[model samples]
Target chain A: MLEYFEILGQEVYKVLFLLVPILVSVAMIVWLDRRVWGLVQKRRGPNVVGPFGLFQTLADALKYIFKEIIIPASANKVVFILAPIITMTLALVAWAVIPMSEDLVLSDINVGILYLFAVSSLGVYGIIMGGWASNSKYPFLGAIRSAAQMVSYEVSIGIIIINVLLCVGSLNLKDIVLAQKDLWYVIPLFPMFVVFFISALAETNRPPFDLPEAEAELVAGYQTEYSGMMYAMFWLGEYANILLMCAMGSILFLGGWLPIIDIYPLNLVPAPIWMILKILFLFFLFALIKAIVPRYRYDQLMRLGWKIFLPFSLIYLVLTASFLFYFDKLPKGNF
Target chain B: MIAHSIFFYFFSVIAIFSSLMVITSRSTINSVFFLILDFISVGCLFIMVGAEFLGMILLIVYVGAVAVLFLFVVMMLNVAEQKQSWFVGKKSNHLPTGLIVSILILLELLVVAGGWKYKENLMSSSTLILSDISNTHQLGLVMYTDYILYFQLAGIILLLSMIGAILLTFRKRSGVKKQSYFTQISRNPSSAIELKEVESNKGVIIDD
Candidate 1:
């Protein structure tokens, strides 16, 4: 009983430790995204808050908190409220398996990648429920688009991950990183990496593929009926998911906590810092894509996902598997 | 052990309750939402039982893909307003048949559970769950080696279903103007542009 209590206490402590940093990072990421956009468009971004607008997210949080949450009379009240909570909870929970360093991570589960995949795939529920519960046409349309978009992209992402898994031969995130000690999977699996990155963009509903919440057509899409903290929850959940995808990209292809080079100077930095740096770099690319690329038309987005990325990733998966098998480079395991 | 049982009961109760709600919910959308809840709780139960890979797969495939598909259909059909009472709205001749089929299924499940003790020697099978390997690794070893044909057959079935769905929904609309990339890109400046000397007070006649 005492041992159980101790384990429970430790888990609570770890969760808090993990969650605080993540929440803080998410807030900063929101601000960073805006600033990056502003810089690309040649404008000053959010200079009114704390130094360099560091506390802008805090002000936004307070504004959302104090604002009234309006539940539409026509809406399914229970589901309407439940959607954002589900989104936020799933977004945060996926971090449990993400290792920051060798010693870090709340739960270093064997199937960490699959756990992330599951949580991300489940994210569609929040949007679908929210849109449906709103009892509005635009939200419904948005939900339908999201359902089709996410499902389409997930197939390609699954194939792309399998390409990496064939080489690593382990589902464990840590083992995936360690396996890339000599050479990151990005070098050999460059095409799949690109496919995975673009798919990740779509998976997180980032711009270009953010047809679900396209402002012009759907008027905020699934979030049309949301307000106050509920809306903020969705926003926060989105950034958190983006961060999760960046972390995933870093772990699978960019070698999670591994240094760029095995030389003395590059390896001098700590593992966790290297991991954070890679994630930030990926996030920078994410923000850059958002700034540069125009939003994709619905048909074009579907075509890109199904016709281009899906077949490409499938072929890549087959190529990777056969190459690994022929070269005897497939990691030996229990299988 | 206490923690394990506690979580087991917790997840199982939610799973059972949500599954009941899935059937009993008035709105079709609400039913789909409850179905998702049921899948999630059942997935939690699978994870708690140490089949983490299967648990995540359940969440990803069933709750994520299948339930979202259900929600999409429910929302698209706009059936939320059709709040018909179960077994009360109209005379349903199939109710007796449904009841009988459901009861038989329950009976079979009960028999399977209750008769487990009599099959003590059933544990001596060729394929045993290895304690050392991860569930995913075990699955791969069995699936890729012994059950490869069956796995490929399943893949073929899914592919056929996908092809069938696409073929069923696909239609050629005559009035719509579709973009033809080949024609659009193939035309050069000389072919696309035409310059003609126009006579005074006369418009240049262009050939279509």
Candidate 2:
């Protein structure tokens, strides 16, 4: 019984260890994103809070916490409150399977990638529930758009992951990274990498595909009715998911925790630092794309997902499988 | 073992309660939400029982895609205002039949659960569950080798359904102006533009 309690206590400690750093990093990333956005627009961004706006996110978080949460009179009270919590919880829960370094994960489950996929896919629920529970037109429309957008992009993302899986022969994130010891999958699977990145943008509802929150039309989209902390939770979940996507892209394509070159001085650095660097690089690209690209029209967005990316990824999958079969490089397993 | 049993009971109880709420909820949207809750609880149960891949698949496919579809249709149809009383509504003529079918299903499930212990040969099945491999790897080994044909057939069925849905919803309106990339791109400056000499007090007939 003592042993059992010890194990449980250890698990809780690990969860806190994983969660606290992630939450802090998420806050930092939010500030970094604002700074980047400011750079793109040629304007000073949030510099008044602290030195170079280092504490802006902290101040914002405090403000959100202290602000009164206003529930719409006609809203479904239970679901309205539940939606933000669901979003925040699901965003944090997916990190259980994500390895910060070789030994840094909370739970190194076998189906780690699938667990991530499931959690990310279920993210639309929060949006939909929030929108519907708000009992308003814009939110309803936003929910509908989000549902369609996420579902469409997930198809191509699934195929792209399958392409990666064929090469690695395992769903484990660690194995996927280890398979890149010789060469990152990005070199061999460049087209799929690009496709995956764009799909990730859509999946996270980032700009250019953020029709769900297109401010000009839907008036903050699904977030129109949300206020105070509940509103902050949605954006918090959004940023967490964006960071998660960046981390996924880094892991799957850039090679998680691996140095760019396997040299003497390069190899001396710790693995988790490399992972963080790659994630930041990918996030820079995300911010760059957000600044440059215009929002896609609804039909155009659907067309890009269904007509272009889906078929391209499908053909790529076939090509990958055929290449593996031809070269006899398919990772062997005990069938 | 005790912890495992406790977690099992926890998930299963939530699953049952939510499933009951899914059926009994007055609001259609509420029913859909309960259905999602039920899917999540059942998925937790699957993960707890060592079928992590299957559990994730259930969460990703059913709760994410299928339940979202239900929510979309429910919200779009504005069915929240049309809440009907359970088994007592004016148009509930099929309630008796529904009750009968549900009871029959419950009995069938109970029978299957009870009969599992008597099936001594079940342990000697050809496709033995391997302990060393992950569930996904085991599934792939069996599926890609022995059950490839069935898998392909399922793929074909899904493709057919997709095509059928597109065909059913597709409509080509007669008067709507649509962009044609072929024509738009093929036109050159010479064909699209002309500098015409105009006679005094006469308009240029550009079409001619």
Candidate 3:
């Protein structure tokens, strides 16, 4: 065992180093979500709690840790216990593939986009499992709605991604950012930017598309039976997914770690700072939209996804393909 | 090289076992989840083989979308045993299937061990060089240049699948009202109708 540990010496350090930012980002996002949402509603927003609610989530976490976990009498024992763990784990794992900076990524795998998508899709299982395991009608209904809603929007999201992938010619997030060094793809692919952003909101089950959590109907949706820390896991995972999506959007469309106001005759800030700033801006946008937009009826939401966004993205993909083919002669960097 | 080979074998065993469980499981829902696990392991195997692009495609398209949809419907319709007949059968055909699967596994093991004499340059020469093209660069190059036609073929396949799915599920139900785009767009109420009134039961009111 000692020899094996020696063999894996630096690998352990690399793993731990990778874990820091992921943990920090999830923690900060949890704090930010509560504070921001509270402020938007014209409330005191955790000011008296501990230094502007910085420690509110932490306090809540501790409270959950000490609380008794009660399984409902009719609940499925094994799945009920495992669902939140899986949900939280998958949500955290997605941050591994996200490129925070050039060298800051953990996995930096080739199929980063696909990995992100796959992990998020698995998240739906967590919701489904939680709902079904509870043996309750409302959660079951919420799970079904979530399954349909996520699946429907994913199609348009995938197609819009095709358009962006065509522009970058790579699936790796770092490579996508490097491709955007000259100009972000948002300039030319503005429509795709819109499609991807909206689809991401839908994908993360944010407000307006948040049918799964429609409190008036499902009484907190798939989490109706959850209490204490189990509920906290679901909450953490939700905000984490939002943060992950924002990070990916920043990296993919917003030139990731590139400075927006590059007026200093050179890009000065480290890539990670720019990445953080871009993510914060996108995060604010996400919260703003959540506050401003009214939830659509279920049918209207489905129609928007399947009818409008899907067809539009397919057309965008075709246009992108045609341009890439026709301009094959152009110098790769010139444009 | 030995570590990589051992990891590959380990994941392959798990993948194969989970895949078998996917078929043999009693509950349709359990079977679906097992199938997801199998696909994830298969994806890991794909990565081990330096086929990252294909692995990602398998992850995104099948495990992410198709398998989730399968699980979703299985859990939703809550099909009774009657409806599960197509998927779950207690018939005793497992023996033959098991035999066939074991035979294939044995053959693969034989090939891996020494039957093919394929182990000579398996690691030293190829392993170091494999890392260079293992990323998306070579995959993109081949996709855009050599396999461009095949890429287009995949697009056509997806398009066909889209149309097929829509056609299969778009049937209008009998009682549920659906809006017609034509009526909504082209309707001029003045052209279609003239207003009139009739006497009410209580008031005996009338209008022209």
Candidate 4:
């Protein structure tokens, strides 16, 4: 019994170690986004209370926990509650497969890339359910737009990822990073990187693709009826997914923990630090894009996703596959 | 052994319970949601079987698309809530279906636990050789080199399904105006409507 207990305890410790970093990482990303936005806009962001407002998310969490959670009288009780839970859970689960550093992943499964994409797509269900459960016109309309928007962008996103998978010849995140050992794939696949970045922003419902929650139109969109901790969960999940995407993009296109040019003791900074720095840069890039770009109209976004991005991604996929084939890089007979 | 056995029993019970609920739930929408839960549990079972790719695909494609479409259709339908209540008094009528499902569930458990040959197979292969090395390369090698033809077949099936769905939705209606470039080119405003000037009988030459 003691021996068995030891094994189970070890498993629990591993799970805990994985979960804590992600939670703290999410908090850090939110704080950094706010502080950096302030710097960029030439204003101090939340400097009053705790040191640089590092405790801002903590304070907000306490408020959310204490706030009255309102379930709309007209809403479907079951789905309304389950929707946010599902959304947050999916967002958290995706990070399980994303490799932070070379060997630091929680579940380094064979199909890590596919698993990430699959879980992320599951997020659309939560959005759809939340909107439908609200039993209101605005939420319903927002849900419809979200469904169309997600589906459209996901097609392009899938195609773009095919290019990455082709370049690496493996679906594992660690392997993908390893493939970038010589030169970061972004140097060669700059156009695909741009396409993947923009499509990812749209996929995550960031600015320029936030028509589903367009304040002037839908009035908070699918989350119109949510309140208290449930709403906070949704917000946190959104930011976390953004962070996860940045981490993934870094792992896929950038050299991940591998240094740029490997000059002057690149080993001095720990692998984890390098990964964090890369993710932070990508996170700032996301915010900068948001600050600069205005929201697109619904039709325009759909057209861009389908007409422009999808074709380019498909072409990129073809190019990648062909290049791999020409170089005899694919596991033979695939081509 | 006890811990492993407990988890297996627990997840199995959950999977069975959720699947039964999928059929028993009153609302079609609720049933569809339950179906998703059932799929997730099955996905868990796949994970236990060391078929992670298959498990993820089950979640990705079936739960994500097919079940979603099921929910969409159910939600969009104008089924009356009262009609759902009509079958409440006829519980006995559903006894056969329930009995059959329970039997099926029992069979599934027996099969999963290896019924008769389970001991033999367990004796033969107790340890699966999965080392610290990543399995992605081997899987890719097998999938591409050995199973490429099967993969292409799956793609063809998907293509066929897409075409079938499109055909079903493509309905032509009579008396609906269809666009034509030639008609637009030949059109003139004067030919489409008549304009006339009349002498004014009242003040200020009224345009009526």
Report the lDDT tens digits of candidate 4 across residue range A1-335.
Answer: 89988987987897789878888878767777787778778878766558988888878788999999999998899899988988888888888887767778778777788888888878888888998898888888888888778777878877777787777767777878877888898998889889888888987888878887888999999989999999988888888789878877888788788877667787777778888899889999998877678889887787788878988888888887888888887643221
Deviation in angstroms for A219 in model 2? 0.7
Q: iRMS value of model 3?
A: 4.4
Give the CAPRI class of candidate 3. acceptable
Which portions of model 3 show Cα errors greater than 4 Å?
A: A1-4, A7-9, A327-335, B77-131, B134-165, B179-208
Alpha carbon RMSD to native, model 3: 4.8
The TM-score that candidate 2 achieves is: 0.92
What does the TM-score come to for chain B in model 3?
A: 0.62
State, as a TM-score between 0 and 1, how close model 4 is to the true structure. Answer: 0.82
* Recovered fraction of real interface contacts per model: 0.84, 0.74, 0.58, 0.48
Say which prediction, candidate 2 or candidate 4, comes out ahead on lDDT: 2
* Position B1, candidate 1: lDDT: 52
Worst 10 residues of 1 chain A by lDDT: A326-335
| DockQ for each model | 0.65, 0.59, 0.40, 0.30
How many times do residue backbones clash in model 2? 0
TM-scores vs. true structure, each candidate: 0.92, 0.92, 0.84, 0.82
Q: How displaced is residue A246 in candidate 1, in Å?
A: 0.4
Off by over 4 Å in 2: A333-335, B84-89, B96-114, B118-130, B181-208
The runs of at least 3 residues in candidate 4 whose Cα sits more than 4 Å from the true structure, single-residue gaps closed, are A38-43, A331-335, B79-151, B171-208
Ranking 1 against 3 by DockQ, winner: 1
